[model samples]
Every structure is written in C-alpha cells, then in structure tokens.
Target: MTPANARLARLRGGIPAVEVGARGIESVARNAGCTRLRAIVISGLTPTEIIKHVFNAEPDIMSPFAMTLSQAYERRLLENGGASLLTAYREKGHLATSEVKISSVADHAPGGGVLARQRRELETQRLLDMKHAGNPLAPNLILNPRLPLALVGVTHAIELDYMVASDDARSYRVGVIKSYADRGGKTDKADIRAACREAAVGTLALRQHLESRGDDPDLAGDRIDMVLRAPGSFVPRLFASMRAESEMASLVRTLSTAPADLDEVEQLVPAGTSFADPRVINQIPNNYRSNCKEHCALWERCRAQALAAGQPIILGDAAAEQLAAAGSITRALDLLDGRGRPPDNRAEAALATELRAAALLLDRIANG
Candidate 1:
C-alpha cells in the first residue's frame, strides 16, 4: 500500500465501531446490509493500538438540530398543559393535555463515560419500575430515557426522544424526532422509512427490556410517533402514529439469524491481520451497490474494484439486473458489437439481440 492509502485506511479504521448513546443504535440500523457494518464489527474487535491515528471527529450535522427542535417541542408540550400537542395524538376524549405530566431524563447523568452511562441506565430502570407499579407520580411523558439492548453479543443503549403513556396509562409509545420537513402532509418517503425503522428498533428494545423484567411486554406498544418539522418552519409537529409491528418483526428475524460474534468474519482474514492495512481491506469481499455510497466508508474502493473487475453492478442495480446475463460490462459490449457469442440460454440470447439493436440505433443517430 502507498503511504496515502495506508493513511486513509488508518483513518477509516480509527472510527469507533459503536458510538456512545443513541447514535450507536441508529448507526447500526442505518448501516445494516452494507459493507460498513462489517467494517464496524471488525473495528470493534480489533485492538485500538493497531489502528492508532490522531484525528478530530466531525461535528454531527443533523442530530444536534433535531435534538434542539425536539427539546423546544418538549417545552411546548409542557407549557399550557400540552395544549398544542394534544391534537397530534390520535386518541381523543379519553385524556386531556392538562391531565398529562411530562418528565425528562435529559439532565440525569449527562455527559459521556462509563459511570455516567451506568447512572443513566439505573435512573431509567427506576422510572420504568415506578410506572409499572402504577405510581401516580410517574410522568406520562419520559424524554431521553435510555433503554438497553443486546445485538450480536454487544450491549447497546438507545435513548428515545419520548416515551408517552397511553390514554389509559396501561401502555407507552415510542417517539422519534426528525428534522426533515413535512409539507402538506408530505415528506421524503425515504426519511419517513428511516425514522420508522429507528422508532421500531427503539420500541423493540423497550419491549424486550420490559419482558426481561417480568412485566407485560405490551406495555411498550407498537405505535410510534414521528416528530417532524412543519412545512414552512422549524417548528416541530407530531405526525400521525405509525404502526411498526411488521418492521419490528423483520428486525427480530434479522437479529436471530445474524452471527453472534466476530469469529465467522475473523476467519476470512489471516491471523493478526490489521484492517489499518489497505491490503487487508482489499482481501475482504464487498457487495458494492450505488446506495452503498450513502452508508459505506469503503464505497470508493469497492466501486473501483468492481470497475476493474468489469462487474456490471457498478452501473447501478437496475442496469446490473438487465445485464445480469452478460455477467460483465466488457462481455455485454462484446455481445452488442457482435464480437462475442451469446450464451445458449434463451435470456442471454434475447438480451444480446436487444443490445445489438440498441447499439445499431445509437450508431445510426451518431452518423446522422
């Protein structure tokens, strides 16, 4: 590896696999099904000394803004007895805004470190226990409550923006605050989907935690609230409740089948291999797709590798599917130019015919 490549590899490998707090769970959920997850797992398992580098972390651009909006919304809910947010809730007549009491865990054990995290966990559990015991003082809305989760043998904690009590106080709902704007009942579908997935994971973690405590898991309902910015302003608005039962089930299935440790992945590399070495990274298999650019740090390397190998996937998924029979871009061009024979398969022959026709049309247009 060249000096520049080695430095880049070290920079990428230096990022902690699991960030502290809720961002950790969000990162894991976002990177699922991508090569980034594999890199994250490897980073976590590898010794830090092997991947040492002095680097300043970039400031998070979105989460802080979202958190600020959420905090402001929370304040609004507290003011005037949550009159502004009452209409956002689907339930009606069974409860009143004035009747709801809001509490926050944001200030409890603030800051990073093992001791602070332990304190936050203990405080969250204590509050949940109170709510379960039907304590009248238990607030209807719990903000920034940290819930524990275990994924692939690694323990993580997810801090939900809000855990609101049901009208009857028999259950709670998960809430996620996002900065994406919702205009005229419309928002980015991808953003909505991502938020829903995050909320589902948070709900699942809360449900599992309740179950572990011998409480009714149903206490954590499937309903999730997405707090999004209003159409024309930064003001937060609660969108309609989304049911995440299917999403939760899908994640549950994924978790059950995933490897429990790095043993399986570690076998792919030679003993004592350091991911800080660009050569070692190249040896690992990667499934490169256009979307991988959004989530994977290794996207550039993977795309270059795919291009070098003449893999059709570098052209995008739809194009790759269409050219699947050709197997490679070079072979596809060869077939189109009549320099290579099509395979005996009917699909390949049909594809070749279509490619040849397209090439002829392009040539005629160019000549004209």
Candidate 2:
C-alpha cells in the first residue's frame, strides 16, 4: 500500500467508532470540499475533553450571545404567535387560527440523555405517521421533530427545530432557526450558507423516510425557511427561503461514498490498535491549512509538524502555491540568501532575481 493510505489506515484503527448526527451533517456540509477533513471525520476522531486539554484549545462555536439569542427566539415562538407567523410567511398567505395547530416533542423528553433522545424520536415518528395518514388531529406545526436517515451501515436521527406544513397541507418545509440576525434584508452570507446546508440534510432525511414509508417524498420540499432575528430586535422573522437541491445531492453522495472509503482504509488497520496510543497518532500524516484552527481538534499538532518539516503551507495557501517550486521554506531562504546553486529553470531564475532585488532594497533602507 502507498505510504499515505497506510497512515490513513492507522488513523482509522486508532479512533473509536462514532455515529453521525445532525451536527455531524453540518460539519460535513461546511467542509464538503475538503477531502482530508472528511476522512478525519469518517475515522471518528472528534474533539474530546482529553484532546482539548492536551492540544491547543479550540474556540467554542456556541458563544453566550448565540445561546441567549437562540433561547429567546424559541421562547418567543412558543409564547407569542411565532408559529403562525412562520407558517404564513412560508405559505405566502394568512393562516387562520383554526388551521394552525402546534405540537411539541421537546416537552415529552425533558432531560438530556439517551433515553430522552429515544423518546423524542419515537414521538416524532408517531406524529409524522399521523400527519401523512391525513389524521385531522395531527399537528400542522411540529417543534423538535426527529427524523431518521438510514446510511450504509448506520442510521442517523436528525432533530429539526421546526417543521411546518404548506398552505394546502399537501407538503411540509423544514424550518431552521439560527442565532444570526438579519440587518434590513441582508444577513451574513457565510452564516446563511451554513444554515442552508444543515437544512438540506434534514430535508433529505425526511424525504427519504417518507419514500421508505410508501408516501410521496415530494411531501418534504427542497426549500428551507430560515428564521432569524429582525434588523434591530430579537423578534424572529423569516429571513430567506433557500433551495437546497444541490446541497442535498452533495450530502447524499458523501453519505453513499464515505463508507467505501472507510472500508478501504480499514483494511490496513493493525489488530488491537487505538488512538489512545500516541505513537499511532504521531504516525498519521497531517493535512494542515490556515482554517484548520477553526474546526480541527489536532490543529496544533498538525501546525507544528508543518513548521518542523519546513512546509510552505504553514504560511497559508497563496504563499504555499507561490513557493511550491522551492520545495521547502529552508530552500526558499537559501535561494533568497544567494547561497544555493544557480537556478535550473525559468521560474526559479525569476524568483531568484525578484528576491535579490527585494534584498538589495531592504539593505539600502537599513543602511539609511
């Protein structure tokens, strides 16, 4: 086997197996284009308390502001007519008091534990079945609905914040409540993209479940209703309706193909290996980038390795690309110092000339 594949195999064996959930889906979607990140996640080496204390501390994604805003938004939705407002916004019409029925699965599952999660899942399925069966008593608005998604060898229960039916009651749209605020008609583009990606995963899971039950998958629409705070107030409003067909297709492909990749990597795992062994972890290759600090638990280790190896990537992507031909930062420094052999290629010769000119300018300035 190739050296890289062998290292990946060792990494796969070292980490414990973990089940992917709604948050996992968001992580995958956020880094959809990063193959190394995807491989790391598939290997099941996530951030843990031990790792956090050992390695550099990762910035918390959930801040106090975010937490407070989310709690307030949910509370307003429950206490006020937020549900009806969202339904009307989604359906693009007025919702009558008689037509809007709100139900909550969160109340049945009070405490946070495995048992609570299971209860919520069961209740969500029961309500969904009733709604699909056209039961008059079925709720039109469901809070904290958990939907199941069967993957290659595992199943994921994705819990959504809200699920509201369309005006005709023939279809349902996923509602994602985010803490990001909307200023006028604009919101943070990156935040919106991330929220939409998460919504896509939920929509796909719901659609697949409906198809499995012999119901119309189209009942789960592709559009996601994003609920965000108003321009200056904490009042929730429907900010954007994003179509997630492309994002959903991308996630489906990832879920379908990830297992095959893992299986191939698993073939090279040694017997009785575990990530708790620091030797095994050190043997694994590191893919370091500037953004690694934002999401990776092993960013410090990876960054140190990159610096020790004199890899130009420690300087960031653009600098790395420009200095690719130099092979290493040490070699680039040697070239700059005019201590290396004559440039063998046009690109290297041009780089040498530029470095000499810049060095000369710096010398003149320093002398003055």
Candidate 3:
C-alpha cells in the first residue's frame, strides 16, 4: 500500500488495536471470561509494533492491506462521490470555501515535491487568517487542509477532510466526508465508527497544528461533523452532533507514547527476513478477530490460526464472552462432560455448573 493508505490503517485500526489492547490487558485479570494470560500476551502487541518488528527484520518486506479489484473500485467510487459532494457545496454557495486538490501523482513527482506542499501550506494559512478576520464570506470551508504530524517517528503531512469555521469565526471543527448515507441521522454502526475514528485523528492533528501556530488547541472542537449523502441519492447531509472526546483521548494517549526496545527486536531477527514466502509472514503472530477480514489481507491466515486453536471468538463476540469462562475448546468440552479440572474460583465453578446442566438438557433432547 501507499504511505497514505498505511497511515490510514494506523489511524483506523492500528491505533485502536493498541488502545483497546491496553484495556484488554488491564482488565483481563478481573474478567473471568477472559483468557487472562493469553489475552495479556497478545494485548501487549499492537499492529504497529508487529509491523515495525517485521519491517525492521527486513526492509524489503512490507505488510500492506490487500484489497480485491472490486473493493478497490468501491473505494474509488466513494472517493469520487465525496469529491463530487465538495464541488456541489461550492457550486451551491453554501459558504465561501478554498479547495486545493493536491494530486498524489503530482505531489510525489520530481520538482513537484516541496513546492506542492509549500503552496498548500501557504493557502491553508491564508484561509486561517481570513477566518480569523471575521470576514463573513471568508474561506470558512477549507478542503484538504494539510496538517503535519509524526506517526511512529516518521513525519507525515496529514490532511484534514475539511476545516470549517464557526459562525463567530472564533473556532473550528474538522469534518469528515464519508460516502455512508445518513438515513434520518442514522447509518451503519461500523461505518459511523470508522468515520469517527478517522475524524478523531484529523481533529488531533488539527489541534497539534494550532498549538504549533501559537493558538489554543481548544479552539479545535472535541466534536466532529460527518458530511454524508442521503441514501440512494447525491444530496448531502451533515451529521454535526457526533462527539469524539472519549475516543480522541484514547487515540491521543497511545499515539503520543513511544515504545522502547524496538532496536533490540530488530537485532534479534535474522537478516533477509522478508514477506517473500507466505510461510515466513505466517510466522509473525497477530491478533485476529472476525472484523479483521474487512481491512486486513492476511485475514484467512489469522482466521485459520483461530480455528486451529478452536477459539470460540472466531464465531463472534457473544460466543467469545459466553465461552470466556471455558478458556478453550478442550476445556469447554471437558466441562460439559464432567471431566474437566476443578475450577480455581467461584466464577468458573458456577460456569461449570451451568455447563453441566446444559449438557444434561442436550442429552435429554437427543435421546427423545
């Protein structure tokens, strides 16, 4: 994948993996349904951590999200639709706006590199000044405003989807334009969640930019507005009430903390460690979930690992929670058969009792 795509993954999935994984580790002990030790081991590793380890192990090896042709087409369509929506906003004169469509191809090409970014930065500043001047028709809406930030020690020119000025021209909040339809202010949970995560990162980046410019980062609002089209139509709708403070706090924490001892891990891994062989890539462990297949290419491999381990989690979240006390498939079966090891605590004991009663009910039903 491109650097842009990799950064997107880090924001949407990698950062979240680290945040939730930390929580999973902390609460694993108290939760009887958790595979305490196993969860702890896995939770300690983030997607970025695994990625860094493998990348350092072999510079030539890159683990990018693999997408099918159809998936790619769908993404392009959505992006084009978002672009069209932005153009529509300008055409309809919703607000005075300055839009700079930074072409990835032109930006990365020779001679276009620094100049292209410099131009965007200048334009972004100009728009900000206009907004601050309280010019009613000032470029209150800025599309693709570049905000720079460091991710995993690499400096990146991050861009917000849209930076909108408040009517008072005293503050701004980031807007994420998503193709997901807002049907009476309702949409797919997963779609909204992903969009929110993306917007949170943009918000954080914008705040960072504000701080660098000697402005109060608080001027960057804790809320993110998701601009979407109505279902089955090109008409745009703005979901402006989505608050992201809680999620943004988690993201900000994990992103700001840097890990130690990566150098040691890199030294230990053998040279020429590349993704050339499927077997080699398989050797690197990853936390697999049912949702992994949505954005991860190695979904099938990870799914196989879960299957081989007989992790009930492979079925669903509910199954994982229900079987948590059982810990493993073998243990669950043993409990049902009244041949499992003695429960270490009251919770497991109670779960065992329930399992035995269910087993008896199943036996009776089978006999009848």
Q: Which candidate wins on TM-score?
A: 1
Error of 3 at 251 (Å): 2.0
Higher TM-score: candidate 2 or 3? 2
TM, every model: 0.76, 0.73, 0.64
Q: Across residues 287-331, which tens digit of lDDT does each residue of candidate 3 receive?
A: 566665443334555678878988887878777788788777777
| lDDT accuracy of residue 320 in candidate 3 | 79
lDDT of 1 by residue, 1-368 (tens): 55533432444454443333443344345545544344444334222222232112232133576668656756665345444455455354334656566665766687878688778778878887878878777766776778787665555576776777743576567777776677754666756767887788788878877898899888787778777767667455676457877667656664554343444444554665545555666766666777655434445666898999999988888889999988899988877776856565887788889998888899899998
Clash count in backbone of candidate 3: 0
Report, for every candidate in turn, its global Cα lDDT versus the true structure.
0.64, 0.67, 0.53
| Candidate 2 total steric clashes | 1
**Which regions of candidate 2 deviate over 4 angstroms?**
1-20, 33-45, 48-50, 53-61, 78-98, 167-169, 184-186, 216-219, 256-262, 265-269, 279-286, 320-368
Model 1: CA > 4 A from native: 1-17, 20-32, 39-95, 216-219, 256-260, 340-344, 364-368
Worst 10 residues of 1 by lDDT: 46-55
Which model is ahead, 1 or 3, in terms of lDDT?
1
Clashes of each: 0, 1, 0
